[model samples]
Target chain A: MTTASRATRNATSRPGGRSARVRDQVLEAVQAELADTGYDGLTIDGVAARSGVHRTTIYRRWKTVAGLLVDLLEAGVDDTWAPADTGSLEADLVALNREVREALSGDSSVTLAVIAASFRTPEAAEALTRFWDDRYERSAVVVERAITRGEVPGDTAAARVVMAATSPLYHQLVLRRSRMSRAEADQYARDSAAAAIAGLLRH
Target chain B: MTTASRATRNATSRPGGRSARVRDQVLEAVQAELADTGYDGLTIDGVAARSGVHRTTIYRRWKTVAGLLVDLLEAGVDDTWAPADTGSLEADLVALNREVREALSGDSSVTLAVIAASFRTPEAAEALTRFWDDRYERSAVVVERAITRGEVPGDTAAARVVMAATSPLYHQLVLRRSRMSRAEADQYARDSAAAAIAGLLRH
Candidate 1:
């Protein structure tokens, strides 16, 4: 999986060319297939047919279905959906909520498939765990900034702060299967921010 | 699925007799098979052999793999793991969190299978949705009691309180694949309770 991921990360050597276009098209096809069939049922041949990319090319590049999915998962997580650094914690959290709402609510099947795949195999689980751990660590900076500004206690748990802000949206989207409108996201942001400010997130 | 669930619900007709024992053995076999093969690869015949129950009996009763899985899901959800009414919002939430943590953390594979099956079919999705909605509604009573005690506003959303209190456990267990400890659950309960008390859960 690491080798394949390295290949994908470096595959952009031909960025801005026909190769990049083909890569984007194939990744799009992969997402569509994931939404339709999930990880268990996904196949390289199916992706080839859907993307009009040759099977030989997909095989040569990705090497396996899990490899292809790892790449897709990485891309999904690396799409630059960063939390805002607004001067105020409340506004920053609201911006972060909106970004997450848009990212996840767009295609829930992808996340579900990743979850399914994660439990099915150790490699997949490691990949998914890394994706989230990285995201959480990166996003915890917002809480750190809040702490620096004295909006929250110095001992506040940054990861917990971020998790408090975002878990409800994930809960609604994945477990509850409910819609997360901007108003709902706003409510969550406000509530979680209030909780953080009150020192509820401190260890 | 409904008829099978009805049968399982009333399977105690021959309490302490062959009928009850058969039901237990069959459900145990279903969970074992679900854990081993997952819903995609599970089969009625496989469950029959594992349980040593006649295939005809299983088919006559459960009718489909999804039906059997649904019954197992219902029984899992219907277990006597109600949220505690400990006369305080914080204590009740802590009790609820412990119950949920114990239930879900007992067998990760079973929940993963339900999630996998849910995304595979509309019926499974409906069953999963119903399971969570029922659990949420049932557990919201703790927050309602808090309102009555004047610990929180009357307009505080009970479901939201419950969701806020419990979503982190689910998020960690299912999505993040992180280890959930008793301390973590306690922290979540306290933080969510504080948020509710601060009127963050209104509406």
Candidate 2:
């Protein structure tokens, strides 16, 4: 197994492990701290005190605050919702947008904080990139399926379509300081997908 | 005049004033460094050396490296392009999208670095917000004009349309690891604008 895979196994395994419960508790504490204090405010001692885990155990598992946060973000990153095979690219995109909007609007304070932290640290950036890339990968599958079904042109760039469908959510989150509502996000997704499909057909 | 306004005046008034030339050289040096080295590689000392200005002069004007970058970004931020009076929202939006696409596709290295830097610094974020808001303000005029011409609903969310028009560029710049070409950008702008216009009209 790769180092990351081994780390994941170590994090989740509990059979005959004395530190299993401690790891779980520490992870939960990190999540709570992220929600309560954001990235900059998270601390190792705080996690230890909250989780009743020894500070040494926490340090042993994760070297820095950012490392702990990376673990938390990785643990909490949800699998992308299954893309609706709604027969129309527009409908599929709307469903995708709804899922994204829900996540963006949800109280995923820990996720947001970790995402913000990614900008400051290369380690965090790599972690966050993996997290985002996973989501993009899932969304790309949906667009690819649409193209295969002739909902969009065969030559349509799935990457471009996905980017068009989801870019507004990131823009609202990072630039506009606004939460993307479900209705608005769905509309954006549907319209953007429709437009991209139309362009693909035309070209 | 406000302090910033006064500073602007002082910086621009003299052909060879120490402050004026130093600020100009610093801004130019920052832009050049950004183009050549990206954001992570930028440094104030390097900029001072490149511009042949005293480090103290740069420090006096901008308190930190982030502050200096903010000023440079603000300097390059463009006001809204002319609104289309084409008697149709579709045409106006298309024109607006074209202008944005041109700006984004041209000299994108500087803009991309600024955007990446914004994620790292609050001052940079403020500057980015102002830059986007300026574009939004200009697009709002076009939307309002479209409403006046009975091409779009009077209550259409002009801000959202403006965002939709530009969001693809942001996605391509940060999420994708490729430079968006002008041709692709133009097609995206046209299709996105059409889609937004169609959605607006449907409502």
Best-fitting candidate, scored by lDDT:
1
Give the per-residue lDDT of model 1 (tens digit) for A56-91.
999998888888777776764555445567898889
TM-score of chain B of each: 0.79, 0.72
Instruction: List lDDT for all candidates, in order.
Output: 0.75, 0.65
Model 2 Cα lDDT, one tens digit per residue, B15-128: 766665777778778877876777888888888889898888878888788988778656544312346677666566666655555444444356667766876787888877
Model 2 - which docking category?
A: acceptable
For model 2, state the Cα shift of residue A181 in Å.
4.6
Cα deviation at B101, candidate 2, in Å, is 8.2
What's the TM-score of every candidate structure? 0.83, 0.69
For model 2, report the TM-score of its A chain.
0.77
lDDT of 2 at B167: 77
C-alpha RMSD values across all candidates:
4.8, 6.7
